[model samples]
Target: MELYRKTLTSATWWSLVIFNLLTFSSCKNQPESTVPSWKIKLIANSTSHVTYLVDLERAIDHILRVQLVQVPVFKGKELIVLQNIMALLDNFNPLYKYKKGKANIKNINRFIKSQTEVSQEYFKGLANDDEFATENYIGDDYIGCLGSQSGLRGFNCSLWNLFHYWTVQSSFSPELFQPGAVLWTLHGYVHHFMNCSECYLNFWFYVQEHQIEDVKTHDEEILWLWRAHNYFNRKLAGDVTEDPWFPKKQFPEDKYCRKCRWKGKWQNDKVLKYLKNIYSSISEVVGLINKEEEP
Candidate 1:
């Protein structure tokens, strides 16, 4: 009888221990600091305005044709995703009323192809047999040049703009965040299209290591990119490829978001809201960009 009682007591104790362990593991995922620890002072002297997106957009177009246009080796779904990226961005087409329907990748690419017209000689002297050279001469301009020196404010910077723009634009969509739409497309693009073999691996590993797939809401998606990109900015702060004009730093610092900074950590809520405004509707962004462009 004593043996039976002892066995029952031991079983109850083990069950309680197992239950506590499972609960702790589950809560480990609940809101923790997304950034690596570092002390950063906010810079408030300069503002990179919305028109920067205009330059960024131009740079992106140039980069795609130059560094990102190699024939992708991806098969099936990922290949399709890469092709349809412009279509995905179609949600923002109506925002720029002055030039409607211009952002569509297919429409613009087709027009360029018509103007320059692809020829065997075009790729004859290039590094990749399938290199796509555009009539606009977008080579190494970081997608599209706005008086930017050849490599300054190029591919990497433009890529950051593209990511931020998509999240902001997509966040307002009727679909709200389509789970992995933006992230998956980006993953596929970098993995298959980027020129440098080493770059693709680094980006791929970072995405896998971070919980990008765990992003269930569009808000989560935006914050995740913000966190990830700021990390990128911090790491690349002094690298040679870093743009001279746009020095990498912890973005949206005290100047950008006065409320985001506390004694040490960021107020994640304020940061998310601030990003949404920065990457807000097409009309708001286009209006500001146009205003900046005016004489």
Candidate 2:
């Protein structure tokens, strides 16, 4: 009887040990999630801001394409390009007009609405007038002249010229002129703009949390992004100019020489300094965060 009882006690102890081992092994073998939980939390807490950032990034890409490449060419036949440019500008107008209260987007929103109405009317007029299209297509110069005569101003002219030039010079398929790319690029700009706006909004929230009344203005935030964008632009230009393939091509003495020299020297140096300033600001913010983390 004593031996049987001892045997039973040993079996029970061994069984308990096996159960614990199995449990631990199961835990150890379980697959860990790949996604960062902290990022998820941050996103969840600031969903609107995140969306805004993404849109602003998209917008920035569109803006860069328009300013650096498209606008410079400005030939005449590309109606789609012009439409896309106008659409993007319209989309971003709201950000510029943000106010403190009562929906805060009065000025820009009004401007966009008016522009949209005008664009719709213009398209309707175009559809009705076959003669207008025939007269406009004689040549690049004629098309540009007609567009200007049509009283389309500002970014509209810039957009019209870019695609027109591309169409005149390149053998690209007509389908390539579809406005979808413009929409997608504009989305990037909107993403970046929203990101910037959220950064400011977050700063404002932080200020409020600390009971601080003073806050940076929206203009200041826009200027900050503009400066950053310009810095990046110069960096990209410098990279291109420094390439062995670039400077070898003979440039026009009257136009390209001075511009290339400036790009290589003063502009590149200034951009580097601007980028350094941005880095310094970021480092200071990081240091503050680290200090706060210290218990």
Clashes of each: 9, 30
Residue-by-residue lDDT tens digits, candidate 1, 119-212: 3233223323232233222122222212123434434454666667777677777363474456555554543344321232334445455654
- Model 2, 175-232: lDDT tens per residue? 3333223322222322221122112231233223321112133222222323322332
Instruction: Please report how far candidate 2 places residue 230 from its true position, in Å.
Output: 32
Query: Compared to the true structure, candidate 2 yields what TM-score?
Result: 0.20
RMSD of each: 16.4, 29.2
Which runs in model 2 stand beyond 4 Å of their true positions? 1-49, 53-58, 61-70, 91-94, 98-295
**Candidate 1 residue pairs in clash (backbone atoms < 3 Å):** 58-143, 58-144, 59-142, 59-143, 59-144, 60-143, 61-143, 62-143, 63-143
The weakest ten consecutive residues by lDDT in model 2 span 1-10
CA error at residue 31 for candidate 1, angstroms: 45
Q: Model 1: residues >4 Å from true position, as ranges? A: 1-45, 48-53, 67-69, 72-78, 94-96, 100-149, 174-177, 199-208, 281-295
Global lDDT of each candidate: 0.46, 0.27
